[model samples]
Target: MQWAYLLGLVAAATAGHVSIPFSRQDYSASAALVKRQASKDITLEALNNLTGGGYYSEFSIGTPPQKVSFLLDTGSSDTWVNSVDADICNNQQLQATLGTCLTTFNQSNSSTYQLVSSDGFDIKYLDNTEISGDYFNDTVHLGSVSIKNQQLGLALQSVRPTGIMGLGLSANVATREKYKTIVDNLVDQGFIDRAAFSLYLNDLESDSGTVLFGAIDQKKFIGNLSVLPLRPRQLATRSHHSMSGYWALTC
Candidate 1:
């Protein structure tokens, strides 16, 4: 399991749902062809929970299955859920950990549970509290996908939103241990093309959301494009240090 603290950035303003087109009308036929060629079908589903501010979907855990509403986060690695029996007053760290004493989910009782070491980083939140714990390998079910031996962060307490599913392509403890994001795992398993996945987050008070797995709607384009360099794997060197500053900006 991976642990992380909430960064206190003001939530991005919600502008309702805006459809992004894959191409602009002024673009030449060639450009339109290229744009269409790059598109794929991506499937997404809306999720709901009893919690007032629930996101679009429920993530499943354990053999019997404990479902928790979670946000799909690309910026972090690890998945966690709020504990039903969390002791908030006695344990401040429990506040930042998902699946604390208040939730019904119990990891300790799961037969397939195994704990991995934390990276020693004190994950802090806006509440000025930190949580510490080792990662865990377990079965994770998201939407129609079921991934066994998934790496996730299991905290002793519960914090903002019940949980998170990290979808970044970076190689971290979770990824190295064969735990992959839903999209990545799908691509690896040849269920979807590598570049076919795209996320369209519709920030609605009702917690409505959508995702496209194999293709996107053609009518959603506005005709803007920016090409960025994909990172190439290489041995650590002096040159790597120079690029670190730029990489941090993107993150």
Candidate 2:
């Protein structure tokens, strides 16, 4: 299930790139578009937000007119951006160097902004610096899709680079009430066929990482796989237990 959450984060951050045009002067003509087959390799790129956070499988964000990267974490439930102008705690020194804070979009620019909840979740380090906030409803654009009033986390704090986005199975009341997830938005807009996606995560040092939509890359697996039954209620209960244990150990 943790893998599922991380896969969601990767799916949310995945972006399409235009292939470089080949020249006919020196090289033979080739296909204008390059489609990569799915594999088990972990994709690598500079996740702008994950600078000092750690070496993580990275993906690019194509929204709000900014490039940001993040660690594919499934343990958290909201997404946030770190602000450079906010005050920082002594213990947050390490994260301070990871990435630049985003300041372009603020409350004033969003016309339909609504804060979801205040008592959502909190993350802190031993140095006393922490990040906390609740889910928020706002418009987020990815690729050609513009998700209106989507539920996302907004963090208010002086931290390193861009904030994080949670991809856990646990959903906030508002999120559940509205049935919103990055995948859901994509599906609704017809960018992807379904809410299910697959991630090929390799060792941190490997240069291969990819996310598959609608179908898995058959070559990556040893044999055929079967679909599992949906168990939303059970998944939610397990998420609660796991989160409680994680917070207790970290706090």
Worst 10 residues of 1 by lDDT: 19-28
Off by over 4 Å in 2: 1-64, 83-85, 89-130, 158-161, 170-179, 202-204, 230-251
Instruction: List the candidate 1 regions with Cα displacement exceeding 4 Å.
Output: 1-56, 84-86, 89-104, 118-129, 157-161, 172-183, 201-207, 213-219, 222-227, 231-251
Question: Model 2 over residues 111-177: C-alpha lDDT tens digits?
Answer: 6667667545355532333665555666665434565667665555534444544444335322334
- Model 2 Cα displacement at 216 (Å)? 2.2
Tell me the deviation in Å of residue 20 in model 1: 19
For each candidate, the alpha-carbon lDDT, in order, equals 0.43, 0.41
lDDT of 2 at 101: 39
| Model 2 TM-score on a 0 to 1 scale | 0.52
TM-score of each: 0.53, 0.52
What does candidate 1's lDDT look like per residue over 186-207, in tens digits? 5565544442334443332323
